[model samples]
Structure formats: structure tokens, C-alpha cells
Target: MKVKSLFVLTAMIGAIAFHQTALAKERETGRSTGPVVYVIAQDKFYDSIVLADLPAKGRFQQLFPGEGPSGLATEYGPGDVGYLGGRWWVDGNENGEMDEEDAYFLCPLLGPGRDDI
Candidate 1:
């Protein structure tokens, strides 16, 4: 009986130690830190991206609306944020390209949104 109890206690301790070590490794690896919120302007394309610490509701970042269209054809303006496949993405309209129709994707699946948390 004594040996059985000792073995059980030892196993529990070992399990806990392993779990802690795994967690520490995960932290050091910086896995699943947070999502990047994309702030898109009404007329922009390229999209303004931000790396958020975490997806917290009511969290905000300032955005500037585009001043008409960019004189340079290659330079894109602003864009909204989006989320899919368990990660924040910026496909704009989800149309596989950035265009005026490509709008922002409100985040809420795992992080922040307008009272959607």
C-alpha cells in the first residue's frame, strides 16, 4: 500500500513538472500572441494594419480616411480589419484582391468587436 501511494504521488509530481515545462517552452516560443487589426478607410485599398497585443473589445487605434485617391497608382490607402481561419487577415473584400469593393471585416470570432465580445 505504501509503495502504491508513493508511486502515485511521484507520477503526479512528474506530470505537473512536465506541464509547467511545456508551458514555459510555449511562452518562450511566442506562440499565439495576438491578432493584428487592420484599419481600412472607406476609399483606400492597401489597408492600415496594426499588431494588437490581444483581441480585447473596445480596443481602438486611430485611422485616417483617405484624401480622395492617391496620386501614385501603386500606393494604396487605408483598410479595415478582418479575421478568418482562426487568425486576423486582410483580403479586403475576400475577393483575393484589394479594391473599393474590398471592405473591412469586423473582428469578433476570437477577439474584439463593437460590443460583440
Candidate 2:
């Protein structure tokens, strides 16, 4: 009887340890929430844009050197945050960088080409 009780307790403790380990892994891999892209203009001709795979956890602000500040950094409630699957923007001068003269626009997250360009 004593051996049986000890075995049961050990098994219970092992199961609990395994459960906690799994929970930790889930937390480590958990995705954050928020806007997928946060864009900010550095100079009159340059823009800074950041892209993320999961939902954004922070605000997206755009500050055009000449145009001033634009966008809100506040979180819009729970699931309201948008996830960016992909993004496309103009690289002014065709240099693969967003410069002052380049036009910056959010491309469709998952679509084929923009007709307005």
C-alpha cells in the first residue's frame, strides 16, 4: 500500500510539471496584438515604416517632416488590432528605400497589384 501511494503521488507531480512546461512554451510563442504596420516620415522626402507578422501591440504613428504628425498610438480595444500579412510601399528613386519624394501607401495585405499606381 505504501509503495502504491508513493507511485501515485510521483506520477501526479510529474504530470503537473509537464503541464506547466507546456504552458510556458505557449507563453513564449504567444503572438502580440496591434496594427501590422507603423509608418513615420522622417524628412520631407523620407518615411520610416515597420512591418510585423503578428498583430501590433503598439500604435502606428506617421510624422512627415513638413506635414507634421499623423496617426494614433492608442490601442483600439481587443481583437480590433489588424494583423499585416504583407505590405508594399514605394521606394522613392527606385532605391528600395522610402525617400522624401517616394509615395508611401499601404498595399493590400494579401492581393495582386494595385491599379492606382
Candidate 3:
């Protein structure tokens, strides 16, 4: 009975240690374990807008009233801070559409003074 209990305890400890190691490795590799939220902007300027103000799909005119049929924004602007080096998509064609012409841009992980971190 004593040996069985010891073996079980040892197994539990080993499992916990392995989990911790995996988590640390994930962090080091910059792999997100949770949902990542992004803000799709209409332009490179990243104009300030309220989340609640965003209109549903097929309603692009609601967000930019008086504008022609500009379709929708295809640029993925920066979201909340702490994601400096994250990857984002840009509308290479400058058109409000996501097609084969779009490209990806990596957020620079620069330090203060515009130095590389």
C-alpha cells in the first residue's frame, strides 16, 4: 500500500513539472494560448473609433457615411498594448477587400528610443 501511494504521488509531481515546462516554452516562443483580438481598420492611420460604433458586415456605408462604395477595411491595426511583435495583415491594394494581393506585416518589437529589443 505504501509503495503504491508513493508511486502515485511521484507521478503527479512529474506531470505537474512537465506542464510547467511546456507553459514556459510556449511563452518563450511567443505562442499565444488564448484568443487574440485584433482591430481591423479602414486605413493605415488607424483612426480612433469606438468598438460599439462598428457596423455589421454588408453595412460598410454605416461606418463611413457619405462615402462611395468603398467596401470594407482590410487592414489589421494594432489592438491593446503588450503585443508589439505580433503579426498583422495589410491591404496591399489599398482597397477594402481581402484577396490574394494582401500581405502580412510583423509589428516591430522595438524598445525605447526606437532600438531593437
TM-score of 1: 0.18
Which lDDT tens digits does candidate 1 get at residues 39-106? 22323222112222222223222221221232111111222342132222222223554333322223
For model 3, residues 1-117, the per-residue Cα lDDT tens digits are 334333433443344344432111233434432212222332222212111211122212111111212211223334434233333333334577643444332223111110111
Query: Candidate 1 or 3, higher TM-score?
Result: 3
* Worst window of 10 by summed lDDT in candidate 3: 108-117
User: What's model 3's TM-score?
Assistant: 0.24
Which prediction has the highest TM-score against the true structure?
Answer: 3
Which ranges of candidate 1 are over 4 A from the true structure? 21-117
TM-score of each: 0.18, 0.20, 0.24
Per-residue lDDT of model 2, residues 34-61, tens digit only: 1122222111111112232212223222
**Candidate 2 — worst ten consecutive residues by lDDT sum?**
39-48
lDDT of 3: 0.28
Off by over 4 Å in 3: 1-84, 113-117
What C-alpha lDDT does candidate 1 achieve relative to the native structure?
0.26
Task: Assess each prediction's global lDDT (C-alpha) against the native.
Answer: 0.26, 0.25, 0.28
